[model samples]
Target: MTDRSPRASRAGLILVPLLLLAALTACGSENDPSPVAPTAASSSSDPADDTAATEPPADAEPAVTLVDPWVAAAPQGVTEAYGVLVNRSTQARTLVSVSSDVTDVVELHETVVVEGGQMLRPVDGLEVPPQDGLALLPGEDGITLVNVERPLEDGDEVALTLTFDDGSSLDVVAPVRG
Candidate 1:
């Protein structure tokens, strides 16, 4: 003959309520959706927005005006030209590629510092951030080119065409500088 204990018999009584409590807790509370829709002003109320919006019309062609558009006035032995790029538009643009008559080939390149020191790295393209611009200037980091396949002589006018991400292009006359 076996005797049954009250504690064991009443175990289900305590366990059921605990299990129900857990199940209820597991059901997440309902969340009220936010009433406000996100907008540029609401999200990022930066003053730059006003400047960017007022600068140019949306449908205007991108002006790839080369800033300090000068190439090294080195002898004809020099095969590369260095300059800077500025996108004077509200919309973001990309430097897809550059072509110059001065050089047999032109490529969009970027510089990266590697290891203990700075190193030059070539990038397929560069992005001009919205409301801002990009620089192709030379630094301790490196420089980009309207690389001429051949050397450009002083007074030799080179045409550089910058292709935008939106399939638009800008022509800049890159002049050789001292």
Candidate 2:
């Protein structure tokens, strides 16, 4: 007689999935050399859902989005990107880093009043409140692109990639303007 218990059945089901996952992971394409980041289960007990911070909940909305993205017109030297970072997710999002197609060096900056005058200073991150937004205004808070590679003429577009604290990134094209 074969002994088949509920626990034994559950164990077999779990083992099958694990084996299948292992096999699929090992079968990578020849051209694809990048590794996919692992996402662990969220330990939160929210009533809505439990998804990783890097991902939106079951509601299916993106965590953050860019609005009115544009780069300042510059002949060379330094310039900045202007945009409004809108947060639609339940949790707040923090912008940790920013990069552009025109320049290799980018930084988060804010205007600070000093004894001499108001000066631009570096900031670590910019937080977008839940269901709110943070605007990048000139002479206020923005992403500074130092040592621009070429001239940023009006109507030209630059590709911008913004990374958040959750390790999720969003890409957008910003048109050069005044």
Overall lDDT per candidate, in order of appearance: 0.55, 0.75
Q: What lDDT, from 0 to 1, does candidate 2 have?
A: 0.75
**Model 2 misses residue 172 by how many Å?**
0.5
List candidate 1 segments past 4 Å from native: 1-64, 76-80, 140-150
Candidate 1 per-residue lDDT, tens place, 1-178, comes to 9877644444443344345434543553212123345576745678766664444445543444455556666555433445445454456787777676666556555555578865566666678655343544543211244433555567777677777788878777777765
* For model 1, the run of ten residues with the poorest summed lDDT: 27-36
Clashing pairs in 1: 103-148, 103-149, 104-149
* Tens-digit lDDT track of model 2 for 26-130: 665323223555344334467455335445334442467776788999999899998777775558889999988899999998878899778998999988877
Local lDDT at 135 for model 1: 45
Candidate 1: C-alpha RMSD to true structure equals: 24.7
Q: After superposition, how far is residue 32 of candidate 1 from its true place, in Å?
A: 42
Q: Which residue window of length 10 is worst by lDDT in model 2?
A: 29-38
True lDDT of residue 91, candidate 2 = 83
Which stretches in model 2 have alpha-carbon errors above 4 Å? 1-61
